[model samples]
Every structure is written in C-alpha cells, then in structure tokens.
Target chain A: MRQNSHGPIGVFDSGVGGLTVLKSLMAHLPHESTVYLGDTARVPYGTKSGEVVTRYSLKNAEFLLEQGVKLLVVACNTASAVALPALEAALPIPVVGVIAPGARAALARTRGGGVGVIGTPGTIRSGAYQRALEAADAKVRVKSRACPLFVPLAEEGWTTGDVPLLTAREYLAEFAREGVDTLVLGCTHYPLLKGVIAEVVGPKVALVDSAEATAQAVAALLTERGGLASAGHAAPTHAYYVTDVPERFVEVGARFLGRPIPAAEQVDLTF
Target chain B: MRQNSHGPIGVFDSGVGGLTVLKSLMAHLPHESTVYLGDTARVPYGTKSGEVVTRYSLKNAEFLLEQGVKLLVVACNTASAVALPALEAALPIPVVGVIAPGARAALARTRGGGVGVIGTPGTIRSGAYQRALEAADAKVRVKSRACPLFVPLAEEGWTTGDVPLLTAREYLAEFAREGVDTLVLGCTHYPLLKGVIAEVVGPKVALVDSAEATAQAVAALLTERGGLASAGHAAPTHAYYVTDVPERFVEVGARFLGRPIPAAEQVDLTF
Candidate 1:
C-alpha cells in the first residue's frame, strides 16, 4: 500500500503516560511530526478488563487515524498487551506496540540469568512480555509481578525518598532473589520511577525501558517501510489532545513528558 | 409528592472506593436496600476535571434512576465535591453527598482548634468541605490537603504498612502544625486507612470518616423525606454494577465493602 511518508506518527495511551514514548520519539525520529492523544477521561486502563481496554483502544486509534497519521503506536503497556492484535488488524497504518520491542531489548541485554517483568496488573496478567520473550527463546525464564502502586507514586511526584523506595522494595525485591538479571519496565509510568526501581533491584540488574525500545522499533519500522520523513523537511511539530480538561494534564503531564506540554485541546471521544 | 418507601436507595461512585460508603449504609440503615453503580471504566475521578466528573456522575445517576431508586447517594468524594449540585438539581429525588455530612461531622467534633479536610486533589481543590464548614459556622477555621496516594494505597492493601504511614504523615503533619482538632477523611477510600491516619494525627485530633457520616446523612434524608424502606421489607438486597469487568471490582470491592461482593453486573454507561 502507498503511504504519505510525511504524515505525523500517531501515539495514544490511556493517559499522559504515553508522553514518555512521545519524548523518546522526538529524540529518535526528529524529522517526523507527531500527534498524541491521552484518554484521560478513562485513564489507567491497566486495571480494566480486556474487552473494555480493546474498545477504548479502538476509539483512541480511530481518533488518531482521523488526523491522517502514517503510523500508529500503542504506548500503553496494558493496551498493547490486550489490544495490539485487534489494533494491528483494524488500523490501515503500521501498528507498533511497546511489548514486542521491550521484550526484544530485555532478551538482548540479559546475561542468561532469566528476565523479570514488572507492569500494571492487566499487562502482567495478559502475559504479553512473557510470551514475547518466550516466543523468541523458549528456554528463557521470566518472573513477573504487578506493581500497581508505581503509577500513583510516579504521578504523585514521590519518585525518590523513603516512601517510594519502600514501595519499590516491596514490589521488586523478589526479582533479585529470583535471579533475574534483566527487568523490563513494562508500563510507561514505570520509567518515571526508574531511580527507585534501580536502587531496589541493584546495579547489576539491567533495566529495559520500553519507551526507548519502542522508539527504536518505530524508527526501524519507518525506515523499512520507506515512511521516514525526509531529513530536509521542516522541523517536526507536536500536538496533544485529551478527553478531559487540559489544566491538570498540562500540569502533571510535564513530569511524564520530560518537558512542559505547551497546550492540549479537550476532545469528546464518543464520536 | 407520593413516594414508595420500598424503593431501593441508589448509590454511585467512580469505583470500588464507594463500597466503603455502602458498607456504612448497610450498617446504619439495615432496611434500606441499595443498588450501587461503580464507574470502574473511568475510575479515579479525583484527577479529572469538574466538567468530566459532572458528566460521568449524571450518567451514573441516570443508570440508578432506571433501577427504580427513590433516593440518590453520591458515594465518591470527588464526585460529591464536584458534581453534587448538578446531581441535586438534575435528579427529582433527594441527592445526598459525602462532603456536607463530613464537614458537619468535623465541625461538631472540633474542640475549637479548627478542622482539617483531606481528600483527592479534585475534592481538595473544589474546597467543597471548606465552603460547607464555613457556611455552617463562619468562625470555624479549616485546613485542607490533597492526599492523592491514599486511594491507591488503600486499594493496594498497603493501608497498615510503613509506606502508608509515611505518606499519611507527609500529607497530614501540617494539620497538627495548623492546630486542627478534627481531620475529616473526606474520600470514601480513606476510611480503610483510618488506623494509620489516626496514628499520624494522634489521639488529640479527631478523625471523621466520611463513609459513616454520609451514611448517617443518607439515613436522615430518607427519614425526613419519608422515603425510608419499610422495616418489614424482605432482607435488604444489594446489587452491584460496574462499567468495566466484574472480577477486579468483586475482588477489590470486598475489601472496601467489608464482605465479599457475591456478583456485579457489567454495564455500559454510554446510554
């Protein structure tokens, strides 16, 4: 199928967590413009059922597609785990989900001591990363846990200090005992708590940040599809849309996005 | 207007957090049957905008109204703070919200050392309790803080741990410094962490659980409106409904409700 290489890459997550992926994309694919949608009204899809996640994911993808995006990126771990197959089949554009790329990165970095995966309950329960890793190497062992508090801890700006450290230890201490040399941060929000997580699991444990890996995957896919925007093209622009008021999104989203969100328009996803 | 006292009381919340309120209702008003709708698909209204919260609350109320409810209970603190007025105006039946009852309880118990209101960011930002307190007693001083992590901690079953203790201290220490004699647990989920919160605030400061206060308020309103269910009515039936899947709600809700939720019907609020 013919594609317009200049069309912006579209990214959507349950909420502002996807901005982390957008941040990496800006660094990895500088010439490609992007549109990001945060379904803040129904944020935190990590805890919802597969059917509900899929429905919301489809609506989010539809909204992005209407923007004439050349590619679709599911930046949310839970949605990627539960809705990727549905999205891949439904969207006309090439679809990239964080699970496969992050799994690949973990397998490549592990010292053959097994791999640990940490994410929201839905993502872990779906066994997306575990499946992806095992599919590549059947004998590879994977230990996984659902760290539900990490998202709230990250959003609350308690990334450091005793509270987060204790929370991290509570959730991740087992990985060290399990002898997993590599840990995949399956959720976008987990990247914000990387410091505490790293401290808990120790320095020897290689941490796989899905945002960076997903960006690399998108970059490679665009190159292969001849969908990479021309380097000579004008500087890329970023646009944000949200299903709720933009004030809180603008305020809290900066922490996740690594920069202030200049502006975001409110949208109704019912359409 | 003629009313059927046998009609069940309708309660709605953003998610399982409201189950705490329902627990209080079951204890305080044994004869009053209830139908609860938890908007789990769009849970955590605490972080969303007023417009979005109000819209969701209306949909929830409409769903309950269709269930033949004679009274409405806004069981979620964020919704109570942001959507109570809209609910009261839009619904024909009496609408009871947690904020006013909690504020009244705080004022009644304060030993003239002021009152501290703690809740979600949206609830704290709305200043609903502060306005209610001052409106009732203009000379009463009120301090409020947004304890964003409390809800997640409560749901994650970390209510008794070092993490929650530290978090509660972090958010509530200022109340002691401000000489507040009463601390209102303004969020419904807060009742679950009452032990740690009370420890942080100390024995001198009184902690008012909004679940109990709201239950009392609901009971009083029903009595005044002559809408109380008959004492001889069959064992009060409790029905649960959620916008998302029932499994997580049933599991997490049991903790909040203080008993297992036998079943919860999955629903779509779009109608």
Candidate 2:
C-alpha cells in the first residue's frame, strides 16, 4: 500500500450531522486515521446563506487543517453547495465536498436521467446538485427540494415515525411529482432520515448518500495520491473535536455513527 | 447619557441562539449599534463539559470583543453555567450571563419557595440555576431537569402541539413531581417551547423566560450606567452575523422573535 507522509484526514460539518459522512469514511478507509470535528457549538449550516456558509466552512476547514490533516472533506450540504469552489481554491490540501460525489453517484444510478435532491434551503438554493448532474449529462432532469426541518428532526432522533415520515412526504412531494428514479440525500444529516425518505420516495427510487460516495471518492483520491494508510496500521484511530459540549456530541454522535464516540476535546480556536 | 466611547455590544452564544438575546437587546436598546455573532457554524454548547464550554465561551467573547463590543452577554445557558466566571475575569467589559437573571426572576415569582429549572444536560449538571436560586434565598428548593431535545425541537419550530406537549410532559415530570411553583426556561431556545411547557406544568406555575429576564437586566445595567439608548431614538438598529448561513438564521429566528428578521449579513470571524 502506498503511504502519504501527512497526518490524519480532516472531516468537519456544522455539527454532529457530518458523522454520517465520517462513518462512511471509517468504513471505506478502515486503516486511515481520521480527525472529525463537529462545530457542535453552532450547527445546522443548511439554512445559512452562501457567503456565511462559505465563511464558516473556511473556519472549519482551517481548524481541521491546523490538526495536520492531509485531506479535507466538507461533510456538509450547505457548505458544499456554497463554499466548495472557494474551499477547493483556497485550501492547501485537496478538498472533496459531499455535493459532487453524491451527484455523481445519483447520475450513475438514475436509469431515466431523472434525479431528485433534498437538502437545506441554502443547498437547494445554490443549485449545485442540479448543475453537477447537468454537467455530467445535460439530458438529466433534476428535481430539488429544501428539507430544512429534516436536520433538526434527525438530530432530535426522530428518524422513523409518523411525524418524520409525514414531514418527509411534505418535503419530497415535488420529487415524487417529478418522478425521479434516484434521490440524493444532499445533506449529510439527511442520511439519518434515509428510512423515512426511502419510504416516502418508494422502493423504485434509488437513494444516493453523499457521505458514502464522498468516502469512496476520498479513498480513490488517497489511493491515487499515495495517501492510503499503511497496511497493518492498527484499526484507524478516530478522534472527535467539537466547539461545544463533548458529552452531547458523544451521545448524539453515537447514534449517527452507530457506535460510541471517544471522549472529545474542546478547543478554543479564536486565535 | 454619560456613555463611554466603547464599541458595539458584544453578544456570543454556542450557536445561533444568541440571536434571541440580540433580538431582545435590539428591541430594548435600539440606538446602541450592535455586533452579534452566532457560533452557528459550531453550535449546541449545551452538552459540552465545563472546561470546554468555558474555553469556547472565552474564545467567543474574545471574538466579539475583538470586534469591539462594549458589553458581553453569554447568551448560551451551558456556557453561562460553566464559563461565566472565567469570562467575567478574562474580559475587560462587564459580562452578563442568562442563568442568574432568569433564576432571580423565577425566585421572585415562586410563591412557595419552590422553583423548577429546565435546561441542557450540561446546564442542569452544573447546578447553575440551583445555585442562583439558592443564593437568592437558601429556603428556595430548586428542582432541575435536562431537556436535551427541546433545543432541536424548538429550532425545528415544533413549539406548540400534541407531540411537543407530550415531550415537554415527559421531560418536566420530574420537576412537577418536586412540586415547584415556578419554572425557569434555562436555555435560550427553551423559550420557544413555552406554550407546550406551560400546558404541561399548568398555568399556575410561573414560566420564567431567561431571554426576557436577561433583557431586563441589560436594561437595568444600561440605566445605571447612563448608557440607555436616547429616549427619543427610533427603533434600535439590529445587525446579525453568524458563522453559518444567514437565511436559516432569519427563518428560524423569525419564529423565535415572532417577526420577520431584517436583513442579516454573513461574516467570517474564524478567529
């Protein structure tokens, strides 16, 4: 296996929602050390504007960069939609965002060139997914909706229920009408709502999780760039850092990552 | 008014929640130009440890102070519980926290010296409210419970409904069992759940909103310091800055403030 001299891969989102993407990364790149940061102090980037999301994304990326990460992943839909271009341009390390990967995956799965996307208002408004799909194939018909409440609902652990299912139906009604064959869970947080969303969109529509796809993209990039962790490296270590309370991050993040999170350290990054 | 040539008022929270306190400040002190920063990009300070919350709180305050805020409001309950002392000592400006004011108000309202407090797990565990109430009057029996889901639920606008009411009941049952005559909405976000909480705890239990009480404290401080907005001044201007998207802030904020938020700007305050 090729070896990259640089340290851990840095992944961050507005909050714990990004754990979904981090989880996928852990699964795909089991030997790679990962540094995960959830701006648990200020989360839910989905509803923010492009400029603000960009700024926050930069800050988060900078924080991760400071931790000596070899690669950066903006594991957030809103950030990916609005900040990806600037982040990719500005960051020293290679940056991969969730949007394009998810879009690519959706394009591959869609049989009729019809795809659906759901994320925060900011992500949906940015039209990143539509543009990505179109860039891949102009013939593709893309439908997008902003499921703002889904982040909060999922964070609250309302993943499977009448209320979440009903909310999912209300938000995904447009895609259902447009008859998309594949749907992208545009926001990393949206993956938690996968069950309800899958139920609402029906079994015929393939669900694309950007987290999973982004992880694959990261793995591919690492393999190509000689950044893959050396074989026999004890199961890749995961360290969690948050701007807010670590206990809550552990509790909530455990649910998202499907396992216990090690104690998180709090850092004051105002310098 | 004998006002010092200080910069704008500095307000910081773990996340967008400080916006609620900022809204109240704008309403009460319109002429006072303000700079508001929601660590929206890294929120939910409620679940972190005291050391971490304090560290983040100091960083947040330092950021606002660097922007030249004359006074600082630790608008987050978890931060207030853990970081108030450190903030007051470290910052030059007078630092105010939500817990003391809200606890005082609840103590004032409780007829039987029985007070209930609800906040995030960190806040409840810190015993900030309990200490504040007891400090006001040792005879006051303080009952505290952590309502971890309330913040996410409130952020999602699930304030008043059968589901919210049921959740409130489940969380508030312990407090009700303690026979408290007054309840403190410890977290800034908890105010949004007032209706549901009121319904569960009954109208007889006075619901003390920390935001309102904190606003009153600001008013009193300004009056004493002769920094009150000119009496004849028109509505105080409000400017919002978040580390995340401004659109979501305005949308979720509108529900909290019960009015459409005026234009909010996105800012990069990585430091």
Candidate 3:
C-alpha cells in the first residue's frame, strides 16, 4: 500500500447510506483526507441483477480511481455481495467491501456457533454472508434474513423508540426464532437502527456493525500497506459531494454522523 | 415551458431519494429527456436549518440549470418547503416542487376537508402543507405528522406488508385519530410505502401519492407549454447517472420504477 501524497480516500455508495462507513473512517483515521461520492440520484442498489451491479460497481470504482483514491471502499452491501471481485480486479488501489469485514466480525463474535445476518434481499439472496461466515469457520451456522425496512428507517432517522422497535420486531422475527447468539448489522444503515435491533434480538445476541468492522479493516490495511495518514493535519478535511441537493445530505447525515456537516457541494454526475 | 431539443429536464433532490420523482417522470413522460442528480454523498436535508436548506436548494437548482434543463423539479421535500421561492426566483425555467402538487392532490381528494401530511421533520416543521392547503382553501384542516422513518424505510425497499405497516401504524396513529379524509404521502419515497400507509389509514382515507401528482403536474406543464415529446420517438431513451455505484441504484431503482433500469453510468461529482 504505497501511499500517494495528498491523495484522498474515495468511498462511495448508491446514496448517503454509506456515510456510516465514512463516519467510522473519519473517527479511526483522523488525519486522512476523504472524498465521498453518494449516487443520491439513483440509490438503493440492493436489488439489481448481478451483471448490472457489477457494471455499476466498476463504474463507481472507475470514478474513484479517476480521483486518484489511494484506497477504495465499496461501502454498499449490494455491491460488496455482487461486485467486489470485479472492482478489485479492475482497480489499481486496494478495494474493500463491507461483506467480508462483516463476516469476519460475525465469525469472531459468535459464541454458540449460531450467527444471524440481516441485510437487504440481494445481500441475503447472494448467500455472501453465509459463504463468508462458512469460509472463516465451516462449523458456524448462519441464519440470514433480509431486513429491508431497516435501511429506510435508518435513512428517515428512525433510530430508536416505538416505530423502529416495532419494525425491528417484524423484520427480525425469523432471526429471533433461529436463536443466534451473534447478529450482524449487515448494511451500513443498520448501525443507526442498533437500539431497535438490539432490543428485538435481546441482550444475549452480540450485534456486529459492518461499518465499524469495515473501518477497522481499512485502518489495518492502511497501516500494513504504509498508507495511513500521518498525524498533524488541520482536522482532516472532509469534502462531501453528492449528485443531488447537499442540504438533505447534511440534514440526514447529522443524525447518522452525530454532528453538523458544514457544507456539501451539489455536482452533476452525468458522464 | 419552452421545449429545448438538447436540454434535459433538470430534476434534483437533497439525495438519491429524488429518484422516486425521476422514476415517475420516466414512466409518465417517456420521450422527455432528463438529467437527474442526487446529492447522495450528502443527504437527509430534512433536519437542517432553513437557511442551510435554502442555500443547498439554490446550489442544486443552479447545478441543474447549468446542465441545460428546460424545467426543474425540486424533488426533496425539505428543499421544496424552505427554498422554493429562492429556486423559482433564481432559475429561468419553470420550477416545480413536490409540496404544491401533493398538497393540491390532497385537497382535491379530501371529502371531510381533513388532510394528513407526512414528510421529513423539516417539511412538517415548515408547515408547508398547512400553508398550501390554506392557500388552496382556508376551510381545509391540515393534520401533519413528521414521518422521519418513512423515507429511510422506503429507501431500504420496505414498501409493503408487516414491517412497514407496523411502522406506519405508529406514525399514522395521530392522523387516523384526526379523522382525516385524505393522507398525503408528502415525501417522494413515501409513495413506495403506500400499501402499508393505506393499510394503516384504512379505506376511508384516500392516499395521495406525490410522485403521481408530480407526474401529472409535469404532464400538465409539458402539455400547456407544448413541451411534451413527440409521440413518434420509439419508447424514449432513458439514461441513468449517479455519483456513486450504479449497482445499488439499479437494484433499489427497479422497485421504484417497476422495471429493470437500462443502465447507470458513474461520474465524478467532486467540486
């Protein structure tokens, strides 16, 4: 991981949902410059066909590579499940996707050999989580469910209390029945729904947030590859760019990041 | 209103959430070209200060205007609620926001003169629906609630059945109590949750989908200005572009548009 001087880390997703990953990155690597691109114009990539997803992932990687990102984080579950290989193969930089990190974390946390993974339909359907978990340890049984509403609920800033709790109960009933001791919040957006999910899954099941795990992985990679930004820069400038209105990003993002996002630039991403 | 052959219809939002509006546009006005930009990298304009939302709205409008759009539609509720005046004043083309079309449709359908409005906190806080309803006719009593989770849930693709229904029940209880005759799905994403919302509100209260209303309004605007595409164009060309991964957009978008998205291109939107 030869570091490029002043090159920003490029992180991308279909929408601002990936802010969870970026937030984690910022917290862990305070000195690194970050450039985030959220395809707010066309988001929620968890349901497209494999071929289309691969193409889209390639395009996103291309855009980031164009920006000279020293590292690329596919902070989207759907892309990670379907397009990670293509992205890694196509890009010059190290490509990290959420699924592997999440799976790794789940494997580490599970005590009863029962691990439950919850995310979008595409993620669960791809069997990526199951395969990843099994790859780490063949004995671990992975119970997967698609908690689709959690992403939207998180986006709407519905993190706690009744509605999210109720929705969580509804979405996680199968997982609860499976009685997994460890649960993986497979989507980046799921971390926001932590309280509700934790309540629904009970105190016994350890919840693993993919965002946190992915961030940790990024830190390790940067450190190992000698790409970690050295300490002593002006608070690590975060430049936020989106294909839509910046206002909404700041508004919803504050809840996600737990701070005020100063300014975001609206850019035309039509190429 | 003057139709330009080369300019695309400039549609934007605070984030990818606006794709719901673009989905409607594509369905209703297939022949019309569109340039959609979602500030996905930064999003959730719903909770920002009014001044900030206004500034972001202006920037979004300006970006779209620069793209050479014949018309502009501010699809994000927060932006429409707080920044419509500025956007309209600054832009040369006719600017349409979700509030007016949604409010008008609610007014048209409400038999008891009680309309329920659901949107982001900023949209609800602005009392945009109340004002719009009052402007249409002072007699109409507007009952509004901030359904902050609905947007994220919609984005997560939890449009129907148990989880969304449960969430809707929690959010719409007040509206149901108010005995509203119509419920306005104020956020563009809210329409995706129409089934759950309708179930919660029951058959008596008609559900007004903003995307449909906005589509109708766009149709009316095009018809009135003779900007509607000629009928001879073969099924129209639909191009999708995003600042992030196109994979996630295609996946989440198919559900929004009710079909497979042809393809999405990724573009660098850093400014």
Candidate 4:
C-alpha cells in the first residue's frame, strides 16, 4: 500500500465549488491525473455542524482514496475549515486543505495592514482562516464575515451587475472600513465574484484566491516528495464522480472549472 | 397500526423554511399535535435532482410516521413538487403538499389574468405548480421562475431593504410586464419576503401565500377524515427534530415559525 506517483490526485468538495480547486490543480500540474468527488447528495457543508461536516468529509475522502489517489485535497472551504484535522489524521496520504495555503498567501500579500476572510456561515464560524493568519504572524489582524448568498449567486451566474455589487458592498464594507490590505477569498465560489468583490473593497485590498494557492501548494508538496507524475504519460485523465445525478454537476461545474464536463459518473457514498 | 384520530400531524421539510407552513398549520388547526422534522444535514433540496429529493422526502416521511402521526404534510416546496406522488402512494396516511392548495388558491384569485409562480429551481423546474394550475382549467396561463437567492436571503434575515427589493424587482419585473394579476409565493420561505415582493409587484397583483393555503388544505383533509385531534390533549405538544445540530435551526427557524423552537432533537437518517 505504498503511495505511488502514478496514482491520481484526489479532490473533493461538498459540491461543484471545489471544481475551482480541481481546475487550478489541473493547470498547475498537467502530468498528474485526478479523481474528483462531489458530495452532491449532502452539499453546502457551509451551514452544517462540525460533526456532520467531518463525517461527510470522511466519507468523501474514503471514496476518493478507493480510486487510488496519492494525495487528498479538501477543496470545499467549509470542509477545509472544520474537517482538515480529521482528514489529516485519518488518511494515509498527505492531505492538502485550501485554508492554510490561502492563509499563507494572504499573510504574504498583506502590507502591514489587516486581513479579511469571507466565506459561508460554517467556515467563518470555525474561524479557520482567522486562526491560520494569526498563527502565521502574531501581529496579524483578521476580520471575518459570512457571505451565505455568494454561493447561490455564483451558481445562478449572478456574479455581476447590481445584485452582486450591492451584496459584495454589504459584506465587505466593514473590511474596507477596517483598512484590510488583503482579503482572502476563503470560499472557492468567491473567485467567480472577484470583479464585484474587488470593486466593493476598492483597489488597495489584495484578493487571495484559495484555489490558486492550494494548487501551488499541492504542486510544491508533490515536487518536494518526488511524487510528481512523470510527463511521458498519456494526457492526464480527469474523472468526476457525484453522489446524485450528474446533470447539475456537469452544468454548474463548468462555471467553476472554466471548461466543459461531458459527463460525471454517479456514485453512492452511503456505504 | 391504524393512524389514530388523536395522533399528532407529521410535517417534514428540507430545513427551516417549512416552519412557515407549520406556523400556519398551528394557527389554523389549534387542536392538532404536531411533529416537525427538518432535514438540516442535507438542507436546501431546491437545487437538487428529483430522484435525490424524492429519496430524502421518503426517508423524512418514514421518520415522521414513526412518531405516530395521523396525517403527513410535505411542507417543503421542492419536496412537495417532486415527491408528492411517491409520498401519497407509499404512506398509509393522507398526504398534503403545498403546491396543489396554492395552485387552487391562485386559480380562485386570478381574474382573467395570468398567474406567476416563484420558487426554488427544483420546484420551478418540476413544473408542478404550472401543471396543477393548468390541469384545473385548461385555458389558464402560468409562468414559473426560480428565485434561488430568496432562501439564503431569508435565512440571513435580509428579507427587506434595497437588495431584496432590487432582487424582487428583477425577478418580478417579467411578471409585471406580462400582466400576471396574481403571483403565487410558491416556496415556504418566500412568505418572509412579502413586503419587498408586494412593493415590487405593486398593489394590483395579489400575492398568494402557499403556507396559509396549505394549512387550510390540511385542516380540511383532517376534518373530512375525522382525524382532527381532540381538544383535551395536553395543549397539543409540538415536537421538533433535525438531522444536524439544532442551534442554527432554532435561531433561523424562529423567523419561519413566527415564534421560538425551544429545542430540536438530532436524528440520523443514514440508514
């Protein structure tokens, strides 16, 4: 049961939001194959309790591990916030969660100013990003807000115009007032609303995309461990699995992944 | 075992939104004891597939039925839309869903003008309301739109104000332009946004509250079947259950139920 470099990288999200991370991973490490599991049957872990999210995350990770993945990626922010420790302990493979990478990027980007983290209720409530930022630097000031509507807006493709603009302003006005120089896009879906978020927070605040940071971190970890897939393999295959019907995942997932998903195999995590 | 006349009515929703329907049911049927089950672990069935929703609804119904209830109420609009037939066929007790009653009320209220129905994507996509409305009268015109943000907005307590007003205007403008004289507040959570919706749609268009309609429907069905709980039964105990932690449910559920939910016991639906 030794970890092999040829095995696919495992990535999971509560739902399609994690596709952003998968997309980044694909771009960052072209030679690595990937197996993605979208826990569609019980999605939006953002509003659920820590125990419930952890249980669900464990199931998702187990399913991904069965696919012979070398490393596990907790792509969902809510899971990354609440279940990362559990995953790290339970999984034999190395686990990369989006929170730490995003936090590190935010800390590095901030210029002696505070940092703001925006995400779902559960993620913000967990204070994972806040803790990560503060843990990295004792003097780092962190402010957090829960933007529950952003996921729905992004899925509905309402990222632009008045509705999103007003929503972004309402959620980020305090961050702007607090003079935060870097705002971490704590949730994967938030990257889609980058323009509106940037517009609301103004020019000074640097936006850290968790997807990009996590992908880079993953690449670095694999490179250092000598687990990177060799480049001579047939164009790295990407396989998708979901706990529910594949239609919605393929449709909305395209928005997050920035490409077409022809099909996704149906999976049942009940076992 | 036979469904007893004095037994509590069983109600289930994906989450707290159906508390609105429960609120009306409590008001309209004061003598009836009730057991409400919120599927908080996998909440927001709005955007999920029909098969997944029906499966969840069935599990929810089974849990409620085990509570020894006389009647079943599909309080969630998405569940009511897609799972009514299966629920009605599988359960021994009579099942009441919000869609049929709301459609009937809309049919009665509309004065030669078209009817507009607004709800979650799953409910709208199922075309349940449109089918029900048109089935009653072949000549009646119906239009349905999914307002995905409304649920999150309601949960966030952003029921009124410029953002919701603008969102309302954006969603309702088409109905206004198309001259729909009546709009059916198809989703249980939408009753919370009545003020903003009313203002946006104007005075001429009467908005039908499905919760009120559904409550009356349940009352009539129970009365007809001689299943109404007798008045002497310990002030009609109202028990609440959820699949996840009760904190968020109790907090946001108060808004939907129009009062307090002192506590909600957690239950596992994994089997």
Give lDDT tens digits, candidate 2, residues B1-271.
4545335677777666767787787777767777777766556677656776676677678777777777888888888898888988897777889988888888779898488888998899999888888888988877788887788777767777665776787688777666788888888888778888988888778888777788889878877887655644554455567766566777777765567878666665555
* Clash list (residue pairs), candidate 1: none
* Candidate 4 per-residue lDDT over residues B25-95, each given as its tens digit: 99999988999999999988998899999999999999998999889999988999999999989998889
Per residue, candidate 2 scores C-alpha lDDT tens digits across A1-271 of 4435448999988878788898899889878888998876555567555776687678788888888899998888888888988998888888899888898899889899488888887899999999998999889988778776787677667788676777777678777777889988887787778898888888889998888889999999998988877868666678899876577788888888888986998765544
Model 4 CA deviation exceeding 4 Å by range: B1-3
Candidate 1, residues A1-271: lDDT per residue as tens digits? 6568989999999888989899999999989999999999888888788999999999999999999999999999999999999998998889999999999999999989999999999999999988999999999999999999999888788899999999999998899777789999999998889899999999999999889889999998888878899988778888999998888889889988888889999999943
Candidate 1 chain B worst ten-residue window by lDDT: B219-228
DockQ of 2: 0.33
Q: Write the per-residue lDDT of candidate 4 for residues A1-271, one digit (tens) a residue.
A: 3358899999999899999999999999999999999999888888889999999999999898889999999999999999999998999999999999999999889998888899998999999998888889989988899998898888779989999999998998999888999998988889899999999899989999889889999999998888999999667899999998998899889978999998999988854
Mark the 10 consecutive residues where model 3 chain B has the least summed lDDT: B40-49
lDDT of 3 at B128: 89
Runs in model 2 deviating more than 4 A are A1-10, A13-19, A22-42, A56-73, A91-94, A161-163, A173-179, A219-268, B1-44, B47-76, B156-166, B173-179, B218-268
- Per-residue lDDT, model 2, residue A8, is 91
C-alpha lDDT (0 to 100) for residue A125 of candidate 4: 94
Give per-residue CA lDDT, model 1, range B1-271, as digits (tens): 6467988999999999888889999999998899999999888899888999999999999999999999898998899999998998899988888888888888889989988889999999998988999999999988889999998998888889799999989998898677888888888888889899989888899888778888998877777777788877688899999998899899888888889999999999853
Q: After superposition, how far is residue A174 of candidate 1 from its true place, in Å?
A: 1.0
lDDT of 3 by residue, B1-271 (tens): 4676445688887656777788888888878888877655335677555765676667667766776788888888888898999887887788889888988988889886488888888899999889998999888887888877777667766677666777778889888777998988777777778788887788899988787788889889878987777766545555566645576677767776677877877654433
Every candidate's DockQ is: 0.74, 0.33, 0.19, 0.76
User: Model 3 chain A, poorest ten-residue lDDT window?
Assistant: A41-50
- The ten-residue window of minimal lDDT in model 2 chain A covers A40-49
